[model samples]
Target: MPTLQDVAREAGVSKMTVSNVLNGRRDRVSPATIARVMEVVTRLGYVPNASARSLSARRSNIVALAFPSRDAGGVTPMTNPHDSLFLSEVEAQVTQAGLYLMAHSVNSVESTAHSLRSWNVDGAIFLGTRADEVAALHTAYDAPMVFVDNHGTSPHISNVGIEDRLGGQLAGRRLIEAGHRRIGFVGPRFDEPGVVRERHAGFVQALTEAGLSLRPEHVVHCDAGFDHAVAAARRVLAAPQRPTAVFATADIIAAGLLKGFVRAGCPVPDQMSIIGFDDLEVARHVSPEITTLHQDIPGKARAAVEVLLTQLAHWPAARSERRVLGVSLVERESVAPPPAS
Candidate 1:
């Protein structure tokens, strides 16, 4: 519905300036101006004609937004608002760069390679992939690769991730400062490398620094959605010595936990307090506002695109770097001091 004129006006730049930025003519525009134009483009949801633009560029100018399959059938669902917002920003960048975007949900190395080679892909940004797997994909596709939320280190890969461990520490310290000791952590308590695992590790480290410990029984492992969150919370509720507070590593999970507590008649902040990560839209809309850790999805998305584009423009010599985004705490009505004995 929005046009180039709208984006140009919104970004307070000339039409030519907008065009230069959108067409990947980086030398003609300042970094600050390019960032400004891209932000406005995202805000206005400006989608240009991909076919016409790509032909003019000569390059296929197609970016692959890939992810590992969530289910057994190699289908990854893009159902979360956070993921949607992240993708929305990435789409903005892709459009600004005059590129066509393609999405793929791949489960195996073979399938992933097939998708990359099958399409006229210039670059790829993937979710939930490992460092070694990233290498494998690079070996197969020979395109610029950007990975999100992967904790494992690999020199040849470009990554955009949050300081998940630091976020956990913030949540744990906040709960401890609020006078909660018997804390329950809800999320997938896995030994594998990922955001969830890093957050749990940070939380445990924080507890250890404060002379507290998270007993194995206090850890509830579950998936990242609301249904799994409710079940995970219910497990904590059933524990012999119920925790006074629970910090679900994600806001979506916290939303579920909050609902589970209410459905089970547990008084929020009276019987239990809750904290969540990735301050989602639901955090503020819920009955009692959810206290959460905030991740700058837009900023992260921008950085991820910048990394990929830089690689595309200067590959074989471009630096394979990791960009770590910061996280902050959003205190609201959910957290409270431990209930009286």
Candidate 2:
């Protein structure tokens, strides 16, 4: 209930000195004075007014973390392991940088722009946003913005993403190295212009180099959800000539496929092999731990936050930057040589 003025009066110091000490501008005041002011502040239980401080600093000290409510494939960002984990990491990094994160699931460019305008956010970090949506938001919002997992080509937009194509190639090569000739691919539509499309392209490249082409029926359209992947698994199982190995674009989908295969009494790696992308926690926890491509979710989160903060610090003078992290293959128990007839 005590105010800053009360603390200043009790400490026998000017309100400006108390303000400097409380705001961590300690260079302006002696250590002894800082200690004394802090002691009085603790004793008085005084709290600074956030609105007043923000107004004086011309910064809200808050950043927005926006992602689509449902991605192009109708997969909820929060439910997807990679997206959720990245969000957690971004929040942690933002907090460590002495800023607050406002995570929002955006449905449209208009709505997102309105929210950002209303909140007066210092900047924004977007995840799983489509290229078109990113372009629209960039034009609509004046604040510094950074995109993650977006394939926008604008020279002025900052972005952080992984080698999605290389990830797909790694997954495909692993299956092929394990002697899987008849293989299937599972993920969002391959035609979409995003991470999934890049990954699928890389997968096709690897297959073509090996003189093998993925059959149309073997390419399953499933989002990053348990039910969708489970249905895809059923379709794969019912095929007259099922693939010996399957590459799932996301770990969540792979986990669901594993569950579906179990329910159908299909033995993994013995009768069928599976490889997944994104070495998420679910990849290891599932039975016959999934072999997957390791994309650094934490690294991506760090880069996104760092880029957005840098833009915020430099404002209009900041040059846009793009960071593309690498990926690696993780061999696990889920993949093996094709079963002998």
**lDDT of candidates 1 onward, in order:** 0.83, 0.85
Clashing pairs in 2: none
Point out where model 2 deviates above 4 Å: 1-47, 70-77
Backbone clash tally for model 1? Answer: 0
303-333: candidate 1 lDDT, tens digit per residue: 9998998887776577887999999999899
TM-score top scorer: 2
Per-candidate TM-scores read 0.83, 0.85
Ten residues in sequence with the least summed lDDT for candidate 2: 19-28
Q: Encode model 2's per-residue lDDT on 222-259: one tens digit a residue.
A: 87887888888998887668888899999888988988
Looking at model 1, the pairs that clash are none
Q: Please report the TM-score between candidate 1 and the true structure.
A: 0.83
